[model samples]
Target: MSTYMAFVYGILYLLFTTFTFVFEDAYGFTQSNVGLVYIGIGVGMLLGLAVLGSASDKIAIGMAKSHNNGVIKPEYRLPALVPGGFFVPVGLFLYGWAAEKHVQWAVPLLGTLLVGIGIIVSFMCVQTYLVDAFTVHAASAIAANTVLRSVFGAVLPLAGLKMYSKLGLGWGNSLLGFLALAMCVVPFFFVRYGERIRTNPRFQVKL
Candidate 1:
């Protein structure tokens, strides 16, 4: 689940990194203007972090208080993904189709902001979930997640230009959005069945 979260995050970030080029080529924004436009996503990310990062813990604590005699389970952190899952695909499609159609610049920028918020929200939940689940081996789990995500982050952008060229930004980003949409199932599955999966002897950490 952590790795899958990372993969989705990697792709979202790749889109962000390449957004400057899109602004210039599609919207004819000057380089200076493009830099300014980036502030939208940056601000959006910070907002998401501020809001959702702390909310994950609060939500978990609240859940614990309600059930399990106040002993928090890792799965409690996963509910944050529900909102994020909805935002990401919506943002992606908004940005993609808006850019391809040459809509107002603010429209695409708004989409970028939504994507940024979605990324941070989902990322915080996944990070907290991994740590909560792995406990003694949390560091190792995080390392593996980082490596896989970094690999995807590095490789996916390499194809960005080709994808946009062939399909145009609309369909290209739609493809990425579709993938993110599919991944929404991942967290839901874990929330429902993670305890059983984690209880398997194979997942236990040896001292």
Candidate 2:
């Protein structure tokens, strides 16, 4: 589920990182101005990480107190993913649609803010969840996920111009919106039945 959320968040990161050029061109903004928009995303992300990443641990640990189960249930880590999942598509759609329509520049700016918040929240959840769920192997797990995602992160921006050109912002972004919707289902699957899959001996112990 954490990896799934990362995939969704990763795509959004790609969307914004690649397509900010759209704002720069559409609004005829200066590079500094455009850089400020990117900076807003960076600032928003840092704020989220500072707050939510630490808070979620408190939340999980607090919830575990009631169960008296010495064990921290992976389910406790899920609440954070919920809002993060909801916002990614909404932000992307707003950003793309507003830009395409030539709405006030702030419309897209707001969308960027939402995208920033969503990505931060989702990432923190995934990182914290993986740390909790895997324990001894957590560093390896994070490293592995980081390597794959970093590769995607590096390549996705290069494709953005071609994709946006071919599809136009509306459809190109709509495609991403659809993908986000698909990603939203991942948490539900994991929350509903992921434990069974993880605990199955055949699945858990492997070469």
What Cα-based lDDT does every candidate model obtain? 0.83, 0.73
Instruction: Return the number of clashes found in candidate 1.
Output: 0
TM-score to true structure, per model: 0.94, 0.86
Specify the highest-lDDT model's number.
1
Clashing pairs in 2: none
lDDT of 1 by residue, 109-165 (tens): 888888888878877888888898999889998999888888888887888888888
Report the C-alpha displacement of residue 181, candidate 2, in angstroms: 1.5
After superposition, the stretches of candidate 1 with alpha carbons farther than 4 Å from their true spots are none
Predicted structure with the largest TM-score when compared to the true one: 1
